[model samples]
Target: MSSPCFPPLEPPALSPETPVPQGPVAPPLPLPSDLSSLAFPLPASSPQAPIPPPPPLPPPPPVGGLAPPHVFGLEKSQLLKEALEKAGPVPGSRDDVKRLLTLQKDRFRSDLWWILFCADLPSLLQEGPQCGLVALWMAGTLLAPPSGIPLERLVQMAMDRGYTAQGEMFSVADMGKLAQEALGCQAELLCGGLGGPNRERVLRHLVSGHPLLIPYDEDFNHEPCKKKGYKAHWAVSTGVLLGTQAVPSLGYSEDPELPGLFHPVPGTPRRPPPPPEEGSPGAVYLLCKQGKSWHYQLWDYDQVQDSNLQLTEFSPERAADGRAYVVPEGGVRAGLCGQALLLSPKDSGR
Candidate 1:
């Protein structure tokens, strides 16, 4: 049998930098006379160096002269926890209170998207007064859940839920939604006339550790609105001062000029309403209603300065204590337009 014929072998290609090894050369194989001038392939070049990455971008400048910008995230949860833990048992410590209260402002300053996330509200007063918002925000902080919802998240949720009063005025309904979002429960709303039958019930609620949102009548001028008549405003009742069972009545003066109304000391100048007397029904710690500060340009309900409805045995009359009398006004006839909100969980069954 003929031996197996072998194909001609070519030497392995080497890079130009690699030195060729000295060795005995083999005779070149004979090529067909017809295949003359055969060309050889060139070596491949090294891969081009990798392209460099672009330089990082510079950070954006801070706005409104606020603190450095912060990325919103779960880190806020730690902050909430720290604030609550700092409060300890009593939540009213000045520092703790201030810290919790300022969280909203601090977050607002730190977050670049806060203004936009807040829906760019033109003015808190322009939509609905912030008395209710402040009251609600305060309550939310005090009643913060064990899970620790941040004030920033609360405002964001409020904005998303359309509870921040875009295009319309903020109302009790909006407050309910806000409370529901923050507390994970819908709040209870109380409605009645100022100095109406519900006044006692409101006082009872405040006594039972339930904060009430009552209408505040600003009487800094010392004028009794019942005598002139005015609207009942909104305020949050943090505490209640109980008066004696019997509130002293203003006695009729002999002056013919003022037959119906009782007259105080002659020539007494107009003064701010005095604190409730022993027998007075009671006074509530009305927050966000009467403060004259200009924090957010929100007009407090106290601007109304009076309640048209009055509590009296006979006709509407002022009390003898010389203080402007206001009550949890509620009734179909004349009371606050909004409802008193109670931070309670909503009914899951519904």
Candidate 2:
């Protein structure tokens, strides 16, 4: 037994043919160019995970009624309403009457001429005839002579002659005769008769009275209106009377029957007075009849009390001078004077 055990112990001398145990060797990996390229594996995520959208912006604030961010104080609409109310009723509305009344009560008045100029004359005429008449009368008085004669004596004469006198009642022939006698000219010549000595005599008398009527010598070489200028001798009819003078005159015309004498009153109205005060504000009311048509007007003075007047109104027509004077319809009352004394533009040199 001893011999067999010894041989088993030395049986296999250690040799390369013995099996050897080995540790695991990792699988060959691909190398990257940079150190940051190293990657670690991550766990897989769920397929059902959802993404969210961005939040929405707020809306702009309301206007007018609601106070906006920019407007830190009162609402604009309310302020506007308050302002309009303070301004009172709108123009052309019923409330406008109240505004006018208030203005009148406050004494907001204007000049007479300005008022008439701005007024609607047609409306006024339709509303008040007497007012229209008064305005017309005032205009005439202002522009014309003192209603034919001086106030102090005219009333007495009118009363004595009877208020009912009509159509040359005051002896037109006698008046003509008086003029000739006063002028020291024969009646025939003054009345415009044959030529020669009678005409010369009449001419001389007229020159003496009105120096403006004297004929000027061409050799004088002076202006017709110069201080020493010669004038043509002539007679002028002033409605109720005849005037012979050398002073400049207006409203003159020529008629074959009377060469140098003015036969017809240019702008005169044949009527009795209510004379306007001399040097006072007044007007003339002309009631002229062309056939059956009646024309009325108002006039004003450009200077001090004088016979130079301008038309301011007419029925169914307007004045050429852009002036108008009309009374509110039914607004004119009695006892109010209309006529005014007007100065001649020549006299005023305006």
Measured on C-alpha atoms, candidate 1 has an lDDT of 0.35
Off-target runs (Cα >4 Å) in candidate 1 are: 1-129, 146-149, 166-169, 215-234, 245-338, 344-350
Q: What TM-score should be assigned to candidate 2?
A: 0.16
lDDT value, residue 316 of candidate 1? 43
Q: Please report how far candidate 1 places residue 60 from its true position, in Å.
A: 39
For model 2, how does the per-residue alpha-carbon lDDT over 19-92 read when each residue is reduced to its tens digit?
A: 88788989998767774554643223534334345577676544422121111112435664454446432222
Candidate 2 runs further than 4 Å off = 1-152, 155-164, 167-170, 176-196, 211-350
Model 1, position 231, has a per-residue lDDT of 27
TM-score of each: 0.36, 0.16
Q: Write the per-residue lDDT of candidate 1 for residues 244-340, one digit (tens) a residue.
A: 2222243212223322212223344432123333233212222232222212111212221234233122114333534332232332133234235
